[model samples]
Target: MTDKSRKPVRKAVFPVAGLGTRFLPATKAVPKEMLPIVDRPLIQYAVDEAREAGIEQMIFVTGRGKSAIEDHFDISFELEATMRERGKDMSALDGTRLAPGHCAYVRQQEPMGLGHAVWCARDIVGDEPFAVLLPDELMWGKTGCLKQMVDAYQEVGGNFISVLEVPRDEVSSYGVIDPGKADGALTEVVGLVEKPKMEDAPSNKIVSGRYILQPEVMRTLENQGKGAGGEIQLTDAMARMIGTQPFHAVTFEGRRFDCGSKTGFVEATLALALEREDMAAQVRQIAARLLRG
Candidate 1:
C-alpha cells in the first residue's frame, strides 16, 4: 500500500545532454546513450528501468545531435513492414516502443552541468516530485534501481537518492554522503560531498544516478552557481534542500556499471552477455578462449 500522505512520483527526467568526449571517435557521430549493452542501448536500459518504476511520463533533456534518440522511440514503419513480410520473429523489439504523449523532449542549449540540464525541463516537470536516471550508469538486478528507489520513496517520501558502497580508494571519484542514521536500507543523508578527497570523504557509500527529488529543488538550481568543474553542479543544489526536507539515501543491493568509462562499458557488456540464455554457453567459451590467447 502506498502512503497517500506523500505525493506520488509519476514523472521521470533523463539528462542526456553530455558531449560524450570520453568515448570520442565512436561518440563523434553517435550519442553515448545510444551505445549498446548486450543488444540494447544504454538509453533503453534507463527507460526500461524508469518504466518499471511506474513512471507515467519520460522527459528527456537532449542536445543537438540527439535526434537519433527520438527516432529510436518512433515507430519504424519501413523496418517493421519488412520484418512482417519476411515473417521474422520481431518479438525482440517488444518493449522498445512507447505510446504517444508518454514522452517529451527539450533541448539543453549549452553544455551546462547536470543542474542546468534538469532545469531546462522545469515547465514540463511542473510542481511534482520526479525521478532522474542517468543512462551512463547501467544498474543490473532482478529489481531495477529506480523501482527500488520508488518503493522506498512511497514509504517515506521527501527526497531519495539511490546509493551503493564503493571501494574506499575509489570514493574520491564520486559524491560521498555523510550518513546520520540507518534504518534497514534507508539512511539519513546529513551531507553530500562531490568527489571529496580521500581523507575528507564521510563514507564509502557513493551516490548512484537514480534520484527521486522534490520539485522545489528546481528553484535552487535556478540561482545555482558553477562549482567543481566550473559547471553548475546538481549535487550542490541538492545539498541545500537536505536540512529543510526529509533527505535519505536508499542503499542499492545490486551491481552498477559506470558505462561512461571504457572498462566499465566492456565489463557490463560481458557480464550481461553471460546472463543470456541464448548465448551464455557461447559467451563463456569465447571468454575462456580470450583468456588462453
Candidate 2:
C-alpha cells in the first residue's frame, strides 16, 4: 500500500551509463548525453526538466568515460570568469548550475541495463518516490513532461510513467500499458508488457523515458533477473508493482524526440533550431533548399 501522504518527488535519477554505440566515432570520446540538441546538451535539457518539476537533488548513474557529464554539471569558476571577461551572457549557464549539495553521481561499474543502472542510485533516492528522466528522450512542451507527470503524481499518489500513443504496429518497440479507467490525461495502468509482439500488445499507449517511481521498485530490481534484451529490464520490475501500487500512465502533452537514434537527433536539432529566433530564418532557408533539392 502507498503512503497516502507520499513524499513529493524531490530527486531525479538519470541513467547515463550507456556506451551510445549508435553514434559511433563521435561518441567514441564524447559521452552521447553530452551531445548538443540546439545549444544545450541532451543531458541539460533533461536536468532542466527535472528542475522544473521541483527536483532538489539530481542523481546520475554513470559508467566509465562519463566524467564529462559530471564536469558539465559542476561549476567552472574559470569558465564563468572568462565568460564575464568576454561579456558573454552568463544566463546560458543558469540551468546547468546545481547548488553544492544538490547533485550526486554513482558509477554503474558495468553494462548491466536500465534497471541495474537505476538500482545503482538506490542509496541516494532512499525512501522517496523519485523521477527518472532518460536524457536520450528529449521532450518539448510548454511545461516539462516530468512536471506534467509530477502534477499528476500529486493528484493520484503512486508510481507514474510518462506515456505516448504510438502506432499499433510500433507497439512492440515500447513497453505497452494495459490501461484501465481514464481521467483527463491520466490512465490507470493495470499491466505493462515490455516489447510485446504486436498481436500481444494491450494498447497503443507506450511508456516513454520519464517515470515517477516509488523506492520500493529498487527492492524489486534487487533480485530481478534479466528480461527482454537479456538485461535487468526496468519495465519488468515496474510490471510487478502494478497491482501492489497505484501505477498509472500520464500521457505526455508534448513532442518527444528519441535522441538515441541519429534520425531523431537530427530531427530534434532541426526542430529546436527552427524555434529559435536567431536561427529560425537561416534554418528555414536551409530546410527549404534541402527539400527543394
- Tell me each candidate's TM-score: 0.97, 0.97
True-structure RMSD, every candidate? 1.7, 1.2
Give Cα distance to truth, residue 97, candidate 1, Å. 1.1
TM-score of 2: 0.97
lDDT (Cα, tens digit) per residue for candidate 1, span 5-31: 268898999999998999999999999
Candidate 1 local lDDT, residue 55: 95
